[model samples]
Target: MEMVLEFLGNIPWWGWILAVIVLVFLYDILQKKHTILHNFPVVGHFRYLLESIGPELRQYIVANNREELPFNRIERSWIYASAKNENNYEGFGTDRDIYEPNYIFVKNAMMPFKVENKHPNQKDPYFLACAKIMGEGRRRRPYRPASVINVSAMSFGSLSARAVESLNKGCQLSHAYHNTGEGGLSPYHKKGGDVVFHFGTGYFGVRDDDGNFSMEKMKKLVAENPQVRAIEVKLSQGAKPGKGGVLPGSKITAEIAEIRHVPIGKDVLSPPSHSAFKGVDGLVEFVENIAEATGLPVGIKAAIGKLEDWQALVTIMAETGKGPDFISIDGGEGGTGAAPPSFADHVALPWIYGFSAVYQLFKKHNLTERVVFVGSGKLGFPAKAVMAFAMGVDCINVAREAMLSIGCIQAQICHTNHCPSGVATQSKWKQRGINIEDKSIRTSFYFKNFRKELLEMTHAAGYEHPAQFTMDDVDMATGDKNMINTLADVYHYHKVAVPFTGIKDIMNCPHLGGGYEPKKEKKDVKKAIKNEEVRY
Candidate 1:
């Protein structure tokens, strides 16, 4: 023992350090989990360390305010400020280029509607509500949404339980509805908020042992969860239109398995199309059946692709007077679930194009008022919401914006289940980062602020409610600096008058402007005559 002690004492500190380095090198080379570590040994660890914090580096130091994709720094900052109830006002006049093509300009009225209550502590005088009552005169229980802006469809499986709970609580606080994504309704969703239970081809939560949609199970689900105000059948999402989803066996925890009604540790496949229904006709019938059975408003959500199917559905509805109560248009740009790059990039129509096409079809059939139009592609912003409302959308749903309110940093690594902010991952360790009470309050603040801004814009546009907005109220730049066109001219469809109760009040209000009148441009006669006409 004496000899051993003397030998250890004689060993230099440098020698010991070298020995530790050698051991680490051996571990790195031997590890099979990381190919980089296995191939490059000790040096490879630096790459991983850099990659782990790359998103933060880019967000803070590398990317500019307006450069980031999905959500720019400016957009994120606004959301964060609103969530914290801080000053969201920008110092500068505008960061956006006014001359840019497709730039939306909200035509302010000559005499804007006077806002009554502008006090900070007081509630907003302009209380925004859905213009149309969902399933009014058609269903057993008609629901009038208190707020026009609601939480979009985001499955509990895709998001952590804490995140879902926070969103539900936030929705309750703001009196906004929560759309439970195709993953099925979890206990987290029943937190006193009104719910729009959504199901995809999987028919989760409402499926039987055979993995088929069971009306009995659905009825029971609705009965037990009284918070479920509406039901939405998701034909396809914007992320991957016509494609299905797969929950890997690795992600299928016991809780998830039970909620999804799938066996534990097994891959679950969601087919591209519903087994319960076939074509457009069948889909209408299915929606009608669910509405009939549940005594609640039933809707359909889809990313627009070909117009043939939409045309047929509208036609059938017009002919039979039986169809979905609401139709949610998911723009191709919408992304909550991870999807294949090909589908996410080039598959479905964008929000503006798709919504206009669908709305026009419904208007053509004189069925615009029959169905509530809900748009869900980045319509969270005040300007975007106004544009959507002008194009005939009754409600707007926001998904990623809601996620941002709950501390999502837009790491864009949601698919890996390594969400740093704990908003998207299922890992308990990651989810522990979310503070339910704090985040819930933030969510409520964010939603209320959004509605406040939207209402402010609505009054500025000489209207009491968003439903009073028409295609003529907004205009888009036509790429040429010399010209601009109304949204009706741009989309090639005239706005059909929808029955709105707010229009009468707006017309009667003395403070409100009569109608949108474009300012006539003073033209140069000499230049015009030199360029073309002698007749003038």
Candidate 2:
């Protein structure tokens, strides 16, 4: 009470006026951005603020029912259904996008049906596809994700403790895997849910008192967390490939210090490349060592780089016989916490391109049969996932879009530590706005809907199962009807060795999505918008 009185005493009559003026200024700035402008200054910010909460406010505050969220409406309902142990959804009319360019809408969709209809609308995708991680002749394991959609790498420090707890608990409730991003694994990470503890270049999960990788400590962590499903060597993320992660020291609170096992108030850097491995061959060898040492699937995450590097990598794999269980492709346009504006906007290939390129590369090396590909980049929609698979990707991962489904307003607050959605902020007040139970239910609901939509579309794509649909099954219709991009037109025999012969060698990953023109394939997907000169 004294502290409150003291705080109140500190503010003068002008302080309130100054605060209001500042708020008015911000409101004006935001109003222009949200496209909900009003002439009123102070009052405009209120509308801008509420507009900023566009989808979230509608889903959580206004829509008496929880299932009526943006994008992940069904997902929210599914979680509520599972929690109450009741039916996930009620009979409903269509809840989908009706008008949008470049959409995959059913030309003649069926009229709305009741939840009790003979065909109980599947709450989730009925069929799950499996990806075979290639090892030696018989060493392949099918990587059929229990759920088509899984959590992406949102680090613990980057998010709040309650946020992490909610995500872990949510994963447990939904029976899906959550990634322990580059930040060191928190105790909250071991909340009895499957985890993909990505061992970043800084060796976060293995750091010690000196803040470096400790083999013994790593072994201990692996032994303790039975739920740790896999170990990913995150080489480069899609948003900022060839860049290091920077967590300023000031933000490192006591709890964060304990979780990361690093001293508070010290900047942490996870470099672009790992200290453990040098080149691609060394990369493969180290992944193998980690898998052998940890007894779990070991894979690398990267954005599509130079074609030559990829070609060289496949050759190394063929000769060394060290094949990864999976390869997670991060697209150039992917989102991240706080990257330099340049890197965030102009770094790697878009997921669509990365998906195609990596898919093709894996096929050419015949590693596609052995190594599964998990695609990530602005992907949350069923059409997006199916398209990636049609282009050769095994699975897909979503980040910002997933956050959106779970009530993130994209206020760009992940780095500022002011997320109104508890999912990203450490602030107690902002955190309260994010009801863990409600958000978690919303999370599962979103994933279920995504799966169901994919199944429906994939089934329409002429495949009984999502996995059965091949590239030949997809067809692209553009204004230039003369240039048809069919399933066959998109993929060539994924030959392991590119003919670097008389033809200038080109690095092609099927994930690059066969460009509008084959000649345009050389442009990196990341450079799609800021194109300067053409170079693959």
Candidate 3:
């Protein structure tokens, strides 16, 4: 016993350190996966440690405010500040390069429309409702959206239950609708918000035992969830337009399996195309059947590619008057879901091109008034929202912006199921970080602030509502700083006027109509007089 104890005590601290280095060196050299580790051995371990945290380091220390991709630091800061109800205003001059190519410039009016009761403490002072009533033309159960901006499609399975619950509660508070992504309607989505139930090829919530879309199942699901105000059939998403997704068996929990109606411990495959319908004609018929059966507005969402199918669909709708109540055009840049690099980068047409082309087609067919137009793809910002409205979008959906409002740090590791912020991951321990009550309040604040800024910008442009903004109101700068053209000139299509009867129709508030009122606010008499002189 004395010999063994003496031998153990004889090993010094330096010897222990040396043994660890030897072990690490041998392990690194033996590993075949990493070339750096194989060549450099022990020293390569530091390289990996630094590389793993490279994104965080770049985000916090290296990259400037406007240099980051996707959502820049400046953009994220604004969202976070707005969510927290902090002062989001910047003191210095604009940091953006105003003369850059494709720079959007909103022409302000000489006589800005005076907003009355601007700081009302009521629940919803700025009633930014959509111009057209969904399903009104088809004699279905028509609904008027309470807000122009709403939460976009984000599935419960893709996000944590707490995150979904927070978003729904936030939507309820802000009077915005929540679009349930194709993952199906879990209990988290029923938290008092109006819902736009969305289904893709897999038809998770409305599938039969055989995994086919069942009309009876759809009807029952809709009936049970009265909050589901509309149905959206997703043709394709912006992330991967023609690709399908797989929910790996490892990610499928019992609750998820039940909600999605998929077998537990089995990889659920979502086919790229719908099994129930075949061509564009079949698609129209399918949409019509769903709308007719549910007596609710039904819509289609897609990222644009070849226009032949769109042309055919519009032609069918024009001829038959049986089609979707709304068409949501997702921009190629939009991506909340994980996708292959090639597909995400090269597949779909960007939002501006896709939206303009599709809108022009509908205009040509004289079907613009009959159908509502929704646009999504980084349109959550006030300026972007204004631009989208000018381009003839009736409503805008926000996905990642909503996530940011609820404490997402743009980790960009959403596909890994290890989202550090608990916003995107399904891990119970990770999700525990999301406090639903606190995050829900932040979500409501973010939505309200977004609408408030949008409305302010609308009034500044001499318009009562965003729907009244014409393409002539916005200008885009060409490569040369001196060269600029109106959006109408650039896009080669003028917006067809959609009737906006003011917020009174949606909110029953009498004071919500008109652009300017002289009698109510005599304080802006000089401004109003100057505005009158320049009035067209």
Candidate 4:
């Protein structure tokens, strides 16, 4: 004990200084920046003050085995392994948070194999969501796929060029179509696969050299890719449905600005509403013009506001005898490129409520035959997709899940653009740190397996085809643990077709293949051009 005290007492006062020096040194090396702590000394020495992803970082760099740590490491590695078709198992043991809530297991018993075949003969369902716009003079039309799933909008610009390429390849492999996010179509989009080019208000893919919308240019571009199956005008989205995107100037490279036709360093604002189409008539006109120009499927994506607003759209469709090919509905949970917190938190309608309401309106308009519906917002699990299909959506789109497959730990830093995962970053150094090819392979495998799980889920539900799903298939569980068929209590009339679209053209659209990007013909919306201004 005396010796221990002597050792402690003998410690020099300057020893503390040496320890601080060591910490600063380690921080510098870890940060790879000599100047990070030059002025601030001990405090400023450590640049980033957040919780270090210590175990995750080690798995990526040191362990090299990929899926090692719980949160970040092994999960991304598993995806990478699956994407590349590499060996998936690690001899170590099961890696997951087993204690998480509702961590149930499959009661796979010796049930007859015939149980899996129950839905094998079921047929695909169809939707008819047709509508017309107001100002543009043409009617909008959209078509839903026969089967249930389609690649949600994930543009090359919003994602990395490599990420887009891999996803397109996976889409082709999975026999699915990929939606181009609001980002314009770039070379990365054409992975020799089917793509739905989503046009935001920016006119990304169709912009001419001067960055203006060129109908001729759009026609040519659409013709070039036979995979360009559909066109979507993004009116709004689930996450920031009414909010325009804000591309930090750093991310807006010359090429991107040229494609989007917006100024560099300026916040790229796609105004919440389309000025060219004030009333329902104008909305229908634009849809018709694009359909005529493209000779392919076209639709819109948006969030539902007041009932009267959507009813107004139905009325316009009936009055003009024109409608969109389909409507892609965004829920309050839909993810966006970036948005202000307030708008994301408070603006949009939940998917189930919004989708059902719109589905009823389509039935009422009698336009449901030619148009289709695409659903988004939290489509990560097989059960989630199945429930949505039963509720009424024709197809499902997923965003954050795809990111997770490609190694996003939901760090909530996507808008910052300094993604450590190669999938989201453009920085060669940061991206280089992540093996793109490996991660892509993982992404493909994860999704493929997930689809199989969907099939399994449906089989368990006593359904075969994805289209056989209906509201009755989904049951609501009461607080008392009692279950009741949705048909007993859910409203069916809400989904019926509407004759009088009660409000202005409903601003909601779907985003399965992509989003709707309305064209603004009126140079300035403030000055009166022709008709009376629409009252808020």
Query: lDDT of all the models against the reference?
Result: 0.84, 0.62, 0.86, 0.59
List pairs with backbone clashes in candidate 1: none
Residue 166, candidate 2: how far off, in angstroms? 2.2
Q: lDDT tens string, model 1, 366-474? A: 9988888999998889999999999999999999999999999988878878888999888899999899999999998998898889888888998778788889899
Q: What is the lDDT of candidate 3?
A: 0.86
- The sequence of per-residue lDDT tens digits that candidate 2 reaches over residues 268-329 is 77767777767877777777776666556777788876667777777777777675777888
lDDT of 3 by residue, 1-536 (tens): 99999987999999989999999999998899999999999999899999999999999999999999899999999999999999999987999999888899998999987767653425568667778878885734556677788899999878889999999999888778899999999999999888899999999999988889999888777667667778999999999999876676766889999989899878777999999999999999999888877777899999999999999988998999889999999999998998888988999999999999999999999999999899999999999999999999999999999999999999998887889999988789999999999999999889888988998998999987899999999999987645999999899999999886755554553111121112442234334334433531
Query: Candidate 4: where are CA atoms >4 Å away?
Result: 1-147, 208-212, 263-267, 433-437, 480-488, 491-536
Candidate 2 — which residues are off by over 4 angstroms?
Answer: 1-144, 478-484, 490-536
For lDDT, candidate 1 versus 4, the one ahead is 1
Clashes of each: 0, 29, 0, 73
Worst 10 residues of 1 by lDDT: 513-522
Residue 41 accuracy (lDDT) in model 1: 85
Best to worst by TM-score, what's the order? 3, 1, 2, 4
Candidate 2 minimal-lDDT segment of 10 residues: 498-507
Off by over 4 Å in 1: 1-52, 117-126, 481-483, 503-536
